[model samples]
Target: MTQWLVLAAAIAVEVFATLGLRASEGFRKKAWIAPVVLGYLASFYGLWLTLRLGMPVGIAYGVWTACGVALVAVIARYVFRDPLTWKMIIGIGLIVAGVLTIELAGVVH
Candidate 1:
């Protein structure tokens, strides 16, 4: 339970860090640098903690990346107006579905 919570937090942090990356404007904007770097560091640390708590690496990474990608796409559509076409949405859905399939099937131990 706690491990799952840690994984969830890690995913959210990673998504935030990714958003910071976009806001950084290819690292041209200095204001966003500290936050983006810190956010990534914190997120990776969270992942480590989750793994230490017994969650398998494959499952943890899959969930972390899946949620991060989905959330970033949807949020970027609103925040950055970064073109959220139906095709992209479908692709995101497929990515998430694939990850979930792996998770539910216990494909990685």
Candidate 2:
């Protein structure tokens, strides 16, 4: 349970960092770099913890990235007024399916 919490916090940090980058304006501004770097570091450490728990790297990374992409897109559409078209939805759906498939495949092994 604590591991899951760590993972969730790490992903949230990543998302915030990504959004911060967008605000950073191509990283030209100095302020956003710190948060971006910290977020990535936290995210990696969280994944490391998951790996320590015997989760395969491929499966863990796949699910983490896929879900991150999906959630980021959702947040962007709602928070940033970015358009969420059907095509975008379809792509997110595909990512979700792929992640789930990878996780399930790992379980069967």
Candidate 3:
């Protein structure tokens, strides 16, 4: 339970850092730099905690990255007016499915 929460926090922070990277405007904006740096630092720390809690590296990373990609895509569509094509949506769906498959495999092992 705690590990899951930590993983979720890590993913959320990574998403925030990714958005902050866009807002940084090629690292020209000073204000956005802080969030970008801090968010990544915190995110990695959370991931470490998740790993220490016994989640396998493959399962943890698969879910972490997949969720982050799907979430950032949706958030970018709204926040940045970025296009979310059907193909991208399908790809995201597949990523989610792959993560679930990994998780199920972990459970059975």
Winning model by lDDT: 3
Q: TM-score of the candidate numbered 1? A: 0.94
Residue-level lDDT of model 1, residues 13-109, one tens digit each, is 8999999999999999999999999999999999999999998887899889888889999999999999999999999999989888988888544
Off by over 4 Å in 2: none
Error of 2 at 53 (Å): 1.9
Better of 1 and 3 by lDDT: 3
Kindly give the stretch of ten consecutive residues in candidate 1 with the minimal lDDT sum. 100-109
* Residue lDDT tens for model 2, 30-86: 899999989888888888897787778877788778878988888888877778899
Each prediction's RMSD over C-alphas, in Å, is: 1.6, 1.5, 0.7
Q: State the local distance difference test value for candidate 2.
A: 0.83
Clashing pairs for model 2 are none
55-99: candidate 3 lDDT, tens digit per residue: 999998999999899999999999998899999999999999988
TM-scores of the candidates in the order shown: 0.94, 0.88, 0.97
Candidate 3 global lDDT: 0.94
**Candidate 3 residue 39 C-alpha distance from true site, Å:** 0.4
- Once model 2 is optimally superposed onto the true structure by TM-score, how far is the C-alpha of residue 30 displaced, in angstroms? 2.3
